[model samples]
Target: MNVFEVRGGKKLQGEIVPQGAKNEALQIISAVLLTPEEVTINNIPDILDVNLLIELLSEMNVKVNRTSRSTCIFKADDVNIDYLHSPEFKKKSGRLRGSVMLAGAMLARYKKAFIPKPGGDKIGRRRLDTHVIGFQKLGTQLDYNQEDGFFHLTAEELKGTYMLLDEPSVTGTANIVMAATMATGTTTIYNAACEPYLQQLCKMLNRMGAKISGIGSNLLVIEGVDYLGGTTHAMLPDMIEVGSFIGLAAMTKGDITIKNAGINDLGIIPEKFRQLGIAMDFKGDDIHIPSQDSYTIQKYLDGGVLTIYDHPWPGFTPDLLSIVLVTAIQAHGSVLIHQKMFESRLFFVDKLIEMGAQIILCDPHRAVVIGLEREHQLRGITMSSPDIRAGVALLIAALSAEGKSTIQNIEQIDRGYQNIDTRLQALGADIKRVAI
Candidate 1:
C-alpha cells in the first residue's frame, strides 16, 4: 500500500495547469469501442481510473498507444466483447466504479455486453438501476446473473425514446448519450447531466456527426445517425482539481495561478465559492487565486446561518462538498455543509473532528462546520482516506495542520488525481508519496 506523508503548514505558491478530467477520460475512452477506426484523444489524464479503463479496452482487443503524457491514440479494430466477462477482466473492471460505462460502449458496438459489478467507494448504495432503466428504455433486454455478479444487456436495434431519469446520474447520462447516438430515432434525454465533462462528450459526439441539440441544459435532444466517423476532440481541464486547488489556496493562505482554466466552462463554481468568501480574479483564460489567511463566511442577508448545499449540475456538485467543508473549517465563520447525493460522505468528518476541527455531524449527510481561522490550528493526525473526494479533502486538511500527518489508502486518491503528490509538490506543497 502507498501512503502520503504531508508536513503540515506549507503554503502552496505557483501556477498549475489542471490535468484532464478523469470522469470524462473514462467515459470517452469507453466511447472508443463504438467505432473501429483510429481515434486520437488529447489531454488524457494518467490517473489510476483511466489507466484501468485503458486496460479494459486493451483486453477487448482495442489498440491503445500512449503518444504523450496527455495524449493517446486508440483503435478498436477488433473488439472481443466476450472477453469482458473473463475473471481477470472482471477483476480489473471491478477495480474502479467507472467500469460500468463499458456496458454502453460494448452494447453499442457488439449489440451485447456483460459487465461485472463495479467496485468503488462505499460512500453509499450507488445503484445501477438508473443505468439499466435508461438502457431498457432504449429497447435493451437486461438480465443479470447475481451469482457471478454480471449484467447482460442485449439489444438488436436501439430505438430512441423520451427518458426522465430516476435522478441526474452523471455516468448514467453518459451511457445513455453514447447508446442513443447510434440508435435509430431521435433521442431526447431529459434531466441529463450537463457538467463540463458531459459537455465534452456531447461535443465529441457532435464532431463524430451526431446531431445533438441543447448543449448546456438538462434536456439533450440527440438525433441518431447511421454511423459515426472518427474525429479529433480535446478534453477539458479538470474543474474538480481546479476547485481543489482553489480551496487549498484559500485554506493555506497561498497565492496561486491556474493557467488555461477554461473559466467559461466552469458552471456556478466562482459564485458557489464566493458564498464562502473565496473569490478569484480571471485574466482571460487564467484564474488567479490570492492568498488569504482567513475570510468570514458570507452570512445570509437575513443574518441567519449560511448554507452550502450540493445538487445536480448548474448547481454545486456533491463531489466538491467535501472540499468545501474542509475549506470552511479553515475560514473565519460557521457554515452548514449539506451533501445530498451520498449518505456516507459526511461520516468521514470524524477524522477531521479528531484533528481539532470544529464540525458537527448533523446527520448522515450534513455537517455544521465552525471555522478555526488560524487562531486554533488543527493538530497533526493519522487518518485513512475513504474515497476520492474525501481523500483529497483530508489531504487539504493535513496540509494545513500544525504537525506532520500520515494519510494511507491513497489508491482512492489515485483514482481521480493524476500524480497528485507530484502536482502539489510542484506548487510548493510539503507532501511526499511512499509505499508503506
Candidate 2:
C-alpha cells in the first residue's frame, strides 16, 4: 500500500492544468470498439481507471498505439470475441466499472457480449437495470449465470426502440446510446443524461458516422446507421478537477490558476464555488482562484440557510459536493449539502470532523457544515480514503490543516486524478508519496 504524507498550512501557488476528463475518456475510449479503422484520441488522462480500461481493450486484441502520453491510436479490426469469456477478461473487467461499456459496443457490432459484476467506488447502489432493460428493448436476449456471476447478452438482431430511463444515469445512457447507434431503426431515449461528457460522446459518435441529434438535451434521438467508421477525438478538460482546485485555493488560501478549464462545458461548477464566496476570474480558457483568508456562504433571498444539492446536467454535479463541503470548513457561514444521487458519499465527513471541522451528518444523503471562520485551524491526523472524490476531499483538508497528515488508500485517489501529489507539488504543496 502507498500513502500520502501531506504537511499542511503551506499555501500553494503557480498554475496547474487539469487533465482530460476521466468520465469522458471512459465513454470515448469504449466507443473506439464500435469501429474497425484507426481512431485517434488526444488528451487522454494517464490515470489508473482509464488505463485499466485501455489495458482491457488491448488484452482483447484491439490494436493500440501510444502516439504520446496523452494521445493514442486504436484499431479494433480483429478483436477476439472469445476473450470476453476468458477468466483473464473477467478478472480484469470485474475490477473496472467502465468495463460494462464494452458490452454496448460489443453487442452492437458483434451481436454478443458478456460482463461480470463490475466494480467501482463503493458509494451506493449503482445498478445496471437501465443498461440491461435498454438492451432488452433493442431486442437483445439477456441471461444470467449464477455460478460464474456474469451477465450474458446476445442479440440475433438489434432493433431500435424508445426508452424512458428510470433515472438519468450517465454511464447507463452512454451504454444504451452506443448500442442504439447500430440498431436497424431509429432510437429515442428520454430523460437521458445530458452532461457535457455524454454530449461529447454523442458528438463523437456523430463524427464517426452515427446520426445523433439533440446534442445538449435530455431527449436524444439516434438514426441507426449500418456501421460506424473511425474518427479522431479530443477530450475536454476534467471539470471535477477544476472544481477541486477552486476548493483547494479557498481552503489553503492559495493563489492558483487552472489552465484550459473548459469553462463553458463546466456547467454550474464555477457558480457553485462562487456561492461559497470563493472569488475567481475567468481568463479565456483558464480559471484563476485568488488567495483568500475567508469566504462566506450565500443564503437564500428569503433568509433560509443555503442548500447545495446535486441534480442532473445543468445542475451542480454530485461529484463536487464533497469538495464543496470540505471547502466550507474555514468559511464565514454555514451551508447544507444534499447529495441526492449517492447515498453514502456524505459518510466521509467523519474524517473531516476528526480533523476539527464542524460538520453534522444529517443522514446518508445530507450534511450541514458550519464554517469555522478561520478562527481555528484544522489539526491533521491519519485518515483513510473511502472513494475517489472523498479521497481528494480528505487530501484538500489535510493540505489546510495545521500539522502533518497521513492519507492511506491513496490508490483510490490515483484512480481518478492523474499524478495528484506531483501536480500539487508543482504548485508548492508539501505532499509526497511513500510506500507503506
RMSD of each: 1.2, 0.7
Q: Pick the candidate with the highest TM-score.
A: 2
Error of 2 at 192 (Å): 0.9
Per-residue alpha-carbon lDDT of model 1 for 97-136, expressed as tens digits? 8988887777666778886887988799898888899889
Residue 431 lDDT in model 1? 94
Return the top candidate by lDDT.
2
Could you tell me how far off, in angstroms, the CA of residue 66 lies in candidate 1 after the best superposition?
1.1
TM-scores of the candidates are 0.97, 0.99
Report model 2's TM-score to 2 decimal places. 0.99
Considering only N, C-alpha and C atoms within 3 Å, which residue pairs clash in candidate 1?
Answer: none
lDDT (Cα, 0-100) at 150 in candidate 1:
83
Clashes of each: 0, 0
